[model samples]
Target: MAKDKIVLAYSGGLDTSIILKWLKETYDAEIIAFTADIGQKEELDGLEEKALKTGASKVYIDDLRDEFAKDFIFPMFQAATMYEGQYLLGTSIARPLIAKRMVEIARAEGAKYIAHGATGKGNDQVRFELGVAALAPEIEVIAPWRSEQFRSDFPGRAEMIAFAEKHGIPVTASAAKPYSTDRNLLHISFESGMLEDPWFDPSAEENEEMYVLSVSPERAPDQAEYVELTFEQGNCVAINGEAMSPLQVMEKLNELGGKHGIGRVDMVENRFVGMKSRGVYETPGGTILFTAHRKMESLTMDREVMHLRDSLISKYSELVYNGFWFAPERLALQALVTESQKNVSGVVRLKLYKGNVIGAGVKSPVSLYNPDIATMEADPSQAYDQGDATGFIRLNALRLKVSAGVNQSK
Candidate 1:
């Protein structure tokens, strides 16, 4: 008789390694481990060998960096999506892509169940489960952290460590690292552990070593550097005269932005799980691209179209943050975003100085700003009629004037 097969989203981390073994023991099933390389750097090293040694019948490490940058990061930036007006949604955005690939592997391997290491108290479990439901409704999810049997078996880290030791599964995780981090092409996020304290200062000198992608603002170079970006249809196409693919663009910008200590944010944001979580993030490339894109839009995007699109940004951001990337409502919002960017082709220059992305200049062929009509000097063309302002102001103020008169008469 053949055993049931379960595909697990494995990172070779302590939690995932333990879960890999636990799933096999609990279900008497064959375990296939899958890892997605979306630019997590050196974390991918020796992952396959480690997974196989830890009892995975098969292992897969897929590279999705290009797809992640172009399909996910660039599209989100086109709308300038930000959660709660500050966070770049770095960690929130990566979950769906990871879950998407896991489902594909599950189907190919004839696995009916997909398991993940996301804890029930956090948002990632919601993200992973929702993504699987949306993409493959028939597949079942096996989340051990949320399972009563698994929770009862391993009550804490001590029990988990003992289980791994008894099984000879090597683990490097320990209490030494105070916070947890998630890294991708777009950004690196640090949260939990010491960061859970709302009043704790991540910028303190003691915690300075925690930042991975950027230097401290105080230690950045005094000289300001200028960078030029070209955009077409709301996507960054080039940087400093070098035309590059989305992945290449992100890599180059990350280097530049990191040198100047740009794109560091620390804040307490409301999570979809109804709790406030504090996180520190370094999104150097994303911040630079976001600033440049907005400047370019100002030059070429129409007034009313920009206004209408801006109104939906908050809702659009919420959808992405809450694991609705595959939902119908988000697709409708993205359609409006795409139409608004038809004319948003332009060049923007910015000055990067010690974490500041300052606008230097912007120009576009389809620019709506007519100097002749907007200039303070005498217009020989007589482009804008000065006399038109009288009726424009009177017509707009008529209702206000009537309301005042009614109040006075009363």
Candidate 2:
């Protein structure tokens, strides 16, 4: 009888490297390793050779950077999704894409079970499993961290390292670090291990070296740098007057923002699994784009439409954070968000300083700002009548007057 095949999301890392071999041995099945290249930088080097040598029957390294930036990152940016008003949903957004691809590979490989290295404690477990269930309901998910047998066999990183050596797995001695990091085109997030303590500052002089994307604010250049962003229907299409694709725009912003030491965030946040986790993130490109996008909206978006969309920010962000990216509610909300951006086309100039994105100027062809109506000086056009405010104020004051009378009677 032929053995069942399991498709595993492999990341050429210690946990995934061990999981790949363990899955094959425990299940007595063939393991097909799948790695998604979403701008991990140099992490992709030797990934295929490493996976095959470890135990994977076949290896796949799909470059999903363009799809990730244009599809996932851009749409979320349209909604201005920031979990808790700070997080750019960087790590939160990438999980669905990875899970989506894993499902595709599982179906293509005729694999009944799909596995992942996401642990039982973190949000990735929920994200990976929920994404798979939403896409392929019939596919079985194998979470080794939740398995007692797997947990007992490898109690900690030390035991895993031992097993890796015994099984001829490749892992450097420095693999066991003080914290863990997840990276993609949008951002890089650091948490867990030393970051579990909310009081521990990752930006301290001693610990600041851990940051990978930007320099400390104190170390940034004395002079501020100016950048210009051009947007079309809420999507950034160019930087500094140069037209480029979504991926290219992100790359340019990341470069400039990183040079200016921008987009570093440290906070204690509520996780979906009923826990408060401390996370430090570096989102250079995302920060620049978000600021410029909102500035553009101020010029072109309607007041009521922008307000209604703003009201959904919390709910929309929560949905994405809690692994509901594929849910019907998110889809419906996305449609409304997409419609709201129809006129959000404009140009915004920004000043990037030490850890700051300040607005320089904003202009739009569809600008709702009319100098004739808004000018304080006498306007011959009389587009807005100053005398019209009397009746409008009196009518609006009626409710307050009635409430005052009622309160006096009480």
Candidate 3:
């Protein structure tokens, strides 16, 4: 009889390498390794050779960069999604895409078992498993990090390194440089290791060594640089008069934004697992896109409609952060977001200096802003609504006035 087959979401990183070996030893099964390329840059170097050398029966390295940007990143940006009002949700959003692809590969390869290296205490474990459940519920997920057998065998990175050593799997990381990072076209995220301390500031050396997408804010150029972006129906369509595809747009903006040291964020964010974690992120292109998208909306979106959409931002972002990208409620929320952006078509000029994304100007043919109504100069009687303020203020203040009178009488 043929042995069981398992599909592993392999990064060729130390953790996945160890898991790949452990699964083979434990299950005595055939292992097919799959790696998704969502623009992880140098991290993907030699990944195929590493996986095959490390005992993967078959290996797949697929490029999901364009799909990641257009399908996942753009929709989230259209909603102005942010977790805890600070984090750009870079890592959180990538998990679903990875898991979705893994499930598809599992089906194609006739594998019923899907495995990942996400730890129990983390949101990624939840994100990965939830994505699998949503898409391919029939596929069994093996989360080795959460299993008692694996955790007891290898408690930390040191044990993991030892396991790889015994198994003859090569690993480059060590105690000397001790942080975990995840990268994609949108951003690069650094977490864990020495970053666990809430007050710890990364040294200049660490920043320079680890940063791949952007430069340090202090080292950025003195002069500000400007770029213009065009949007139609809430999606960015062009940059600086050059119409480009979604992936091309991100690549160009990332180059420009990185040069100016834009889109660096450091914060202690609340995880969906109910723990706070410190992370440093560089989201050059995403920052430019988010700032420009909002600026365009300020010109074309209706005032109350914008406010209403803004009201739903926190909840929508929560759903995303909590790994609900494929959930029904999130789909409903996205539908509403789509409806609100019907007329959000415009060009927004942005000035990038250091880490700041400043909106310089915005224009749209469908702009609701009337120059005559908003001018500081004198207004005609027909345009003058100055007298309307008295009744408006009185009506709003009536409850306060009544409360004050009641207090005096008492």
Candidate 4:
């Protein structure tokens, strides 16, 4: 009888390599390695062959960039999601889409089990498993980092390295760089290693060497560059007057934002597993989008609608950050978020300089602003009536004056 198949989310990285080896040896099962190509650039090159060499029975590489941007990223941006008031939620938003694709591949291949390389201590375990449970509840999830058998077999990175050598699997990791990284279209995140310390300044040589998508702000060019982004119903449709796909829009912004040293953040955040982790992120294109998207909303969104949407920003951000992308609450919130963006279509001009994205100008066909009403230099007979403010102020102040008079009598 043939062994049962297990589909593993393989990245051609050190941790996943160890998992692939262990899965084959322990279960004697057929291992099918999967890599999602969500804009990791050239890192996907040679991955399929590498997985086969590392004991995978077969390999699947799927290009998921356009879906990643349009379905996942654009919706998150439409809601104006930001985690902990600073993070753009780049890494957090990519998890569900990857998990969704993994589940789909498992069903197609008739795999009974799936595996991932996320550690027990990190948020990814929650993210990967929650997605699995939601999408493929019957499929068993094999998490090597949390398994006692795997941990006993290889105590740490050194043992895993030795096991790879014994199996003739070439690995690129070193002891000096203990931190693991995950990269996709939106951002790259660095955690563990020297970054574990909250006080550790990331400007150290070793830390600087890890950057892939952006440069240091100090080294950015002296000149500034301007770019115009056009949105259609909350989706980025063009850049600098040229029509482009979502993937192309992100690529253009990444190039421009990287050149200007934009989008670098270091923060200590509360993890879903009841602990805090320090992470450094580089999200060049994501930062540019956040800035320009807000400018678009300012022009097209109604005042009360913007305020109501802003009220949900915290809860919405927490759901994304906490691995609840497939949860019912998040889906419902997204429905409202999507409706709120119906009129958010416009062009936002921005100035990109060293580590800064400054709004240059914004305009939209549906803009609520009227020069006749807003401009003090406009004729009093036009648009808004200035005389209406007298009754409006008295009506609003009635309760305040009553409370003040009652207090004075006491």
Candidate 5:
């Protein structure tokens, strides 16, 4: 009889590396490690060899960078979605895409079970599971971190390190650096370890190695550089007048923004599991995209329409953060968001300085900014009558005046 196969979303990290060995030993199942290459440059180095050495039957690394930026990142960018008004949805948006690909690989490999290294405490577990539920409901999810047997066998990181040492699984963990990090093309996230202390300032000495995309702002370029972004129906299509693909546009922005130290966010956000966690992120490309998009919207979008869409951005962001990418409510909200961008076509020029995205200028074919009506230099003949303001003011103030009169009488 053939043993059942389990497809693990392997990052070749400490947790997943240990989990691969444990799954093989404990379940007596074939382990196929699947790694998503979503722009983590060196992180993918020797991952396949590492996974196989760590007891994986086979290893598959899929480059989902272009698809990730074009399909997933751009759509969310169109909505200008930000979780908790700060998080750029870096890790949140990537989870569903990874989960979708994991299910695809599982089906192809004839695997009945899929596993992930997402911890029980984080929002990622919910995101990964919910994505699998939506995409491939038939495939059973085997989350070892949330399992009693696995947790009992390897209680913590220390125990896992010991197991790795005993089993000859080469790991990079040591006493000096203990923080956990997640990195992709869009951003690099750092949390846990020394960051567990809410009051702890991320010291330069301790956290200097965490930066993947950019150097410190103090070391950034002294002179500001201007970049023009062209958008059509809310999708960024060109950079500095050169037509480029979505992926290329982001790549260009990442280069420009990183040099200027434009996108670094350190915040303690409320997780989906109701715990506050500190995450330091570097989202260079995404920062430029958001700033440029907003500038374009200011020139082209109607005031009421912009306000209405802004009201729903929090809900849209929350849905994505909470792993409801495939949910009906999210789809419905996306429809509104997409429709709101129908005329959001324009060019926005921005000045990038050390950690600053300053809006230089914006222009659009759909611009509602009429200089004739807005400029003080407009002809008096074209203006409205000043005498009509008397009745307009009086009528508008009547309720307030009446309330004041009643209050005074009382």
Candidate 6:
């Protein structure tokens, strides 16, 4: 008789490792561990060996960096999408891609069950489950953290550590260093553990090691550096006039933006689960992209179209944050966003200095800005008559004038 196979989304972290062991013991099933390399840097180091030793029958590590940047990050960037006007949706964007790969691997490996370590209280569970449902609805999802039996058996992290100890599973993190962190190419997010305290100021000493992409802002170069970003149909194509691929463009911008200590944001954002959580993020590449794209749009985008798109930004941001990336409403909004960017082609020069992204200048072939219409020095005779302004103002202010007259009469 053959044992049933379950594919686990393994991160080699304490939570996932413990869950991996627990799943193997509880289900008595063959466990296949899957890790998605969406630019988590050193986090992937020795992950295969770690997963295999910890009870995984086989381990699959897929490099999804190019796919992550090109498909997920770039589309979100093109939309100028932010979660609650702050978060760049770093972890949110990475989840769908990870889940998609998990489903693919499950199918290839002939696994009947797909498992993840996301807790019941968090948004990741929804994101992962939704992705799986969208891609492969037939596969059974076994979320250990949300399982009643698993919760009763372990109760908490202490019990999880005890289980690892009993099973001789090598666990690196202890209660002493309890903060949960999620890292990727775009950003690193810190939450849970010591961060639960709303009033607690993040211990600067403890957080010093958290930075992966750049040096401290205090140590950034004193001089400002200018860089030009070229875009076509809302996608960034080049940096400093050097044409590059989507991944290359992001990598180049990350290098430039990191040197100046750009894109570090700390905020308490409303989670999809109706909880307010504090998150610290570093989005160097995304920051530069946003700055340059907005500058380019200012030059090329029509005023009415820009305003209409701007009005929908909050709604769009909320949709991405709330794990609706695969939803029809978001797709409909994205189509409008893409259509709005049809004319948003240009080069934008930005000055990066000590965490500041300052717009230097912008130019576009499709620019709506006309110096002849805008410049004070332009010939007045060539433009519309000044006398037409009197009637225009009077007509516009008629209601206000009527109200004033009525008030005087009263």
**lDDT of each candidate versus the true structure:** 0.90, 0.90, 0.88, 0.89, 0.88, 0.85
lDDT of 4 by residue, 104-162 (tens): 99999999999999888888888888998989899999898898988898877888878
Q: Candidate 3: where are CA atoms >4 Å away? A: 203-207
Residue range 6-67, candidate 6, lDDT tens digits: 99999888789999888889999999999998888788989999998988999999988899
What is every candidate's alpha-carbon RMSD to the true fold?
A: 1.6, 1.5, 1.5, 1.8, 1.9, 2.2
TM-score of 6: 0.93
TM-score of 4: 0.95
After superposing all C-alphas onto the true structure, candidate 6 shows an RMSD in angstroms of 2.2
Clashes of each: 0, 0, 0, 0, 0, 0
lDDT of 2 by residue, 1-410 (tens): 98999999998877899899889889999999999999888878998999999999999999999999999999999998899978999998999999999999999989999999988878889999999999999999999999999999888877887887887887743444646678889889987667888888888888877888888888888999999999999999988899999999888999888888899999888999998889999999999999999999998999999999999999999989989999999999999999999999989999999989999999999998888878889977888788999999999999999999999999
After superposing candidate 6, which stretches have Cα over 4 Å from the reference?
A: 203-206, 384-386, 402-410
Full-model lDDT, candidate 1: 0.90
Report how far residue 403 has shifted in candidate 2, in Å.
Answer: 1.4
Query: Cα lDDT for residue 368, model 3?
Result: 84
* Cα lDDT tens digits for candidate 1, 237-351: 9998889999999999999999999999999988888988888999999999999999999989899999998999899899988988899998898899999998999899999
In angstroms, give how far residue 343 of model 3 lies from its true place: 1.2
Q: Per-residue lDDT of 172-205 in model 5, one digit per residue for the tens?
A: 7755667777888778888877778877776365
Show the colliding residue pairs in model 2: none
Give TM per candidate.
0.96, 0.97, 0.96, 0.95, 0.95, 0.93
In candidate 4, stretches whose alpha carbon ends up further than 4 angstroms from where it belongs are 204-206, 378-381, 405-410
| Error of model 5, residue 69, in angstroms | 1.0
